[model samples]
Target: MKLEDLRGRLMAVDKKFKEMYEGLERNKIKSIIYDKMGKPVSLKKLSGYEIENITEKRGIVGVDGSINSYGGIYPHYISLIQSMAKSTLPKEEDIILQDVYVPLFEDEDGQAEDELKRRARMSKLELQAASFAMESFSSKVIFMDGSLMHYGIDCPSEWKKFKEKAISTGKIIIGITEEVKTKDIAEILKTELNLNDSILYDREVLFGILNEGEMLEFRRDLKSKKSESGIKSCYVRLSEDPQVAGLDFIEEQYVEALKYADLIYTLTPEKGRGIPLWLDIVDKEVKVTDEMVKSLVESTISREIREMLLNPKRSKRG
Candidate 1:
């Protein structure tokens, strides 16, 4: 295509975007949400006195994980997966748990099942690390870096045990999602209004609909043929930025979600995106970088074995 044709296409795309942007009414969407769900939950700033009261018994902890593959394809791949749980208490130490997945060692069906296996393995490791954190630390609040419902889907057995531990120990566990991805609200709206407009996701709908420190009360149900999970989830604007974040809580402790939300909002930076600083620290500690993968594979595996079993032909070409 010539330059003029490309310029014409770009102009058409810009015009279509403006049309869509003009059609959005955030307040109206917010009203529709309240009709389907309940009223919004108001989140107030935590005063020094309030913080002291909440943390008097125990400090908060954050749990996060990393998953990566070092080799080329199929049975030749070696995945490094680990999860870390860190506490805010000065005396407490980080708990790190690791897992290694080699398709050669397992009875995996095919290449198509690789990602699902990786996710399930990562969830298992994360839940185990969380269990350790709850048992070992003096923390009343435990924050997981991603969706709570995800683990339930990936590793249901381990996920149940983790939730049981949380309930038995009287700990508040909340999942913090940097990116929200769910379409229940869209489905509701489409059915109620009887129209198909091709635009209704919780993330896009809640963009600027919520005020800073305010949470849109919601119930996100995870339904599958094998199992069903009913976790309470909400979109909270922790900072002044228009971008919203997702907070998921187990059904057992969702009644006290407000109390936990205050602590989370307090720890998040007022000027930045809405994620707790503790979770960021845990993520940094648990991340499996390329260099770390390289070092682990090179140090542990014999060169002859690596070349015969795990090494890719692309490495030699490069």
Candidate 2:
């Protein structure tokens, strides 16, 4: 393409973007706010006294995991590790409960492949860890790094069991996700208000509406077979960070959920990353670096097996 043509195309896109930006700015005048339960709600900026210097008797647990795979071997293998922290102790001294599993696949089915196997294994490990945390640390809040909803379709029974156990034990389970793609709010606006903006995501819309220390709770529909047992979710902004995160918890524990959110805000650093500090600590502890994987394989497997497992195409280059 000629340079002139390229410049002309770029200018056309820029003009279109400016027009859309103006449209969004005008649309905000008629924007509607709704809670998780689809009821109309008003947004209030939380006061300093409401969130500052808050104290509670409940303990907090943060859970996160890592997964790595080696693909060239006969039985493709993945190393899965989950780390849970009961307290905000230093990373070195923290009594983090860890569960590690290496699943080897010998079948031709894709279910045994790295991605699917990793999701399944992580889901099982997280459920077990949440249960253990609740039973072991009574009345404490259990924080999982992602949605309580199981990602794989094959694990509905396990997922339902976890939710039932959590409800029966009266344990508070909070799932914090850094990124979200749910279109619940957008859909509500389009269907109910007759407003449509396909380009904006839930987070992007909420990002402009919510102030720091405020959250918008929405009731999710549980009638869907894949819903996470009627869990309620909220979009929260803990700090001055422009990004908003999704927080999911059981509907029965609404007050406790807000308390957990305040606690998370307190732990969040002013100038640090948007996530709670405790979550960052647990994530660092659980992350499986490439060097760690290499060390583990070298220390455990024989050199003959390692050489044989190395991808032949890569081996030939040497």
Candidate 3:
């Protein structure tokens, strides 16, 4: 198809998109959200949750994980998982951990085994780091990289351990997704708005939907549907950017979770992506760079091992 043809094909759905947006507006989607199970809240701290109290007494801890693989194919590749949990408090030190997994001995019969193994390993490592952070730091709040539901789904046992630890310790743990991937609100609104044929993710449905400094929450039924056991989620537009973010909370601690919204929003920049600036710092620190991985492999694994077990055929092509 020509460029004009491509443009025309894309434009074919414009009417539907526009009508959907109009329908949401006509129905007062924000109020509908209130009735459904969530309360939209402004980015203001509740009493005793002021900036000084947040930054000093109840410092926010950011936990994030990174994974990198060297080599090709299932059996030949080695995956490295690194997670970091760092407190926003200047006095507290960073908690960093690493795990490496190679599928040399593990039998990979299915195509998905490699992917599953890597993700599970990474999730487990992240949760482990988070649990460690809870014990090491006096800070009561932790902001994890992804949704709480993802941790449970990806690594249930580790999630259970981490959840129990946070609960017993009287600490708060929240998951922040830089890019919202949930579809619960979209599905519910699609039904409510009488758009049965529509298909939309939360990302598309919520684009520019939330007002600046506002968050979208929903009812208990939708919360249970969208989350795994013990987890709940909401969407927040913390910055001037139209893009929104997902914030997941522990079910019982959701009240406490909402109270921290102001603190998080305070850390987010108007000119930046919706994520808090501190979490972005943790992300950069936690990432396992290519140079680091290369140095690690070369220093630890000998030449024969590298040739036989580590290097993929693609490495030699050039």
Which predicted model would earn the best lDDT? Answer: 1
* TM-score computed on alpha carbons, candidate 3: 0.86
Tell me which of candidates 1 and 3 scores higher on lDDT.
1
- Candidate 2 per-residue lDDT, tens place, 155-231, comes to 67776777777778767778888776776665654554444654655665565566666676554442322244566
Better of 2 and 3 by lDDT: 3
True-structure RMSD, every candidate:
3.3, 5.1, 3.4
Candidate 1 has a TM-score of 0.88
lDDT of 1: 0.82
Output the number of the TM-score-best candidate.
1
Q: Deviation in angstroms for 60 in model 2?
A: 1.3
Tens digits of per-residue lDDT for model 1, 1-318: 469989999999999777655545667777887876646778877887887788775788999999887877888979999999898887998899999988888786888687788889999998888899888999888899988989878998889888988888888889999888877666665566553665666677678888888887753343322123657777789988888898888878888755788888888998877898889888888999999999999999888988888878988995
Candidate 3: global Cα-lDDT? 0.80
Worst 10 residues of 2 by lDDT: 35-44
Question: Residue 184 CA error for candidate 1 (Å)?
Answer: 1.4
TM-score per candidate, chains pooled? 0.88, 0.75, 0.86
* Model 2 alpha-carbon miss at residue 183, Å: 1.3
